[model samples]
Target: MSDFPSIPRLTSSKYFSSLLLLRNIWKGGDLSDDMQFQRVVNQRTYKGELILFAFDLCSVSDALNAVLMLRHVGFEHFLPLTDGAATCEALHALADVKALPTTPCFWSSSSNNHKGWDTWGAGAGCVSGERRRGYCKAEQLWAIRYHVAARLLASRVNLLHMDTDTVIFNDIYTRLKRKPISDYSLILLPESPVNGGLWYAQHTSLDSGAQWVIAEVARRTWEVISLRIRRRSSPPFDQAMLADALVSAMKGERHVAYMCEHPAVALQPPCANASQSRCAYRHYEWVVATLDARNATPLYRACFWRGDAIVTTDEHVIARKQRLVAVH
Candidate 1:
């Protein structure tokens, strides 16, 4: 886990005031709707209830299971993001309709978002079915999460961002409740150098500058996948981009840094807008089969995957996926 320095919390008064000010600044009294944009421009966060969420494009099973399993542990209302082509394709999977919270994710590239995230999300390795590292679904989801937390949900009490693939063996939220969310800004679990599988951060815990640093990192993730790092030696790829975001970026003289930190998360996909029920599953099979073919684990789960590859309950998943790839 990365070391975190102590910092002041946002305090509800300050944060709410900032929100009102932001509304005014952006709206400019143009009589815009309370929720300005559909796909993340001005969606109001449900700040009343402190939220817990995880995202996936090709990993709905994992995401939904995370929500259900977490309910067994501590988190009662964990949300699964309906972002990316996969989840949107599987919008009403099983009995998760009531349990799953609504989200304002762009999901697909339909919002006229010029980012062309759909193309950028696939990466070179994903297309070629090779083990070479190129930004893929995980980084895309992370970038989207960062945008939601910092931009839309900035006024929320706390956000517990978990990875869908993880099988929670312990009561993380119970342990987290030991301290107020403000006490720890960024929650990091031991063994995760990059993705942390799960992350916890309070809106108030971080200063705007620190938040922007992370936002910038997410933006950088959009660039074409490359083996070379940036001038200042930014993290090698999207994984490293997140690590640096947590640490802080050297953006000119306004160096924003993390205000609070904790050791607490395990780190652990995307698709086009084709609406076939099997769209996401089909894409995910090829994407993950490549990793399995190479016996590779993503950088986010390097330690955990290496440790747990032998004894596993999830072995069946990969087996099923591999078979799926072979057939269609």
Candidate 2:
């Protein structure tokens, strides 16, 4: 801990309290959103027991490529979204046969939210249809959905939000001495687009400071910006939001470290750590078909909810089996 400069902890501010009060009026009950958002900010102080991660279909072909990589590497304890039964079935079937480690966590927002709810209701009106289509109409929308999915999974499991394109270069569990389980309370990966994208947490305090800034920004911009800035033609919108949050969290901090090896320096992967030899995580650069398609390869598979396969219903046999048979 002494290796990094110390930083101030996040406490409930007057603005946070006012936001909570307004949230109560906007809805009812204990204001779960505020509470949860605060929980993320507050939980950052505690050590996380799990390494949670999330990703969405980059493309049918891109997704298929990722799934193929999953075949080589197994993820039995991570939570991911698969709203469609056909896709879920295919995923489970492949994992079951391959004996790939699979967890019981499967989340879908579409099925969870009740129909006929208010436009701004709990889950009914999450993202406006117009905003959804216009913001990044060219590219697919998957980042924010995973954000909600991360929070939902946080109810039971500590999350490690991973993009579909990312791959573990080493045995992260043994290297970090932390299982991908919910024990530390809260943890998150670091990101500063200006430097590079690195997914590794050396200490809980960084995550704490990082999350504080992100949650505050989220509350402030939820209504106005929806946390997605599209002023430029091309930029990682979600990453920008997260970067803003990280930048905000680092304010007036002494011990806090932000990806970079030295304090107050630009953000970069902390390869100096023993855990990360070269890079803890590697993100495959997004590529398109070129003159030589031979270099390109499919990595994962994902079925969109709008597709016909998503329309078909299928039973979860693996879940049933996991329930019936105890792995001793």
* Top model number, TM-score: 1
Listed in order, each prediction's TM-score against the native is 0.46, 0.38
Query: Best-fitting candidate, measured by lDDT?
Result: 1
Clashes of each: 13, 28
Tens-place lDDT digits, model 1, residues 1-328: 1111221122322212123223322211111123432212332232332334545444555555554454333333233443444344453443245544332222322211324433444432121112245434554445555555554334434555555555444333334444332334444432233443454554332334334434555454443222232221221244444543433221122111110111110110111221122221222212111111111212222112233222112212211111111100
Writing each residue's lDDT as its tens digit, candidate 2 over 1-328 gives 0111122112321111212222212111111346634444343212333333333222323333344433233332233343223334445554566554442223234322323122212233232222333222211223333344334333433334444555543233432333322122222321112211223222223224323333333332232222222232221244434433333232221111222222212232221331221111121111100111121121222111122111111222111111110000
Candidate 1 runs further than 4 Å off: 1-57, 89-91, 96-112, 116-119, 123-138, 168-171, 179-182, 203-210, 222-236, 249-328
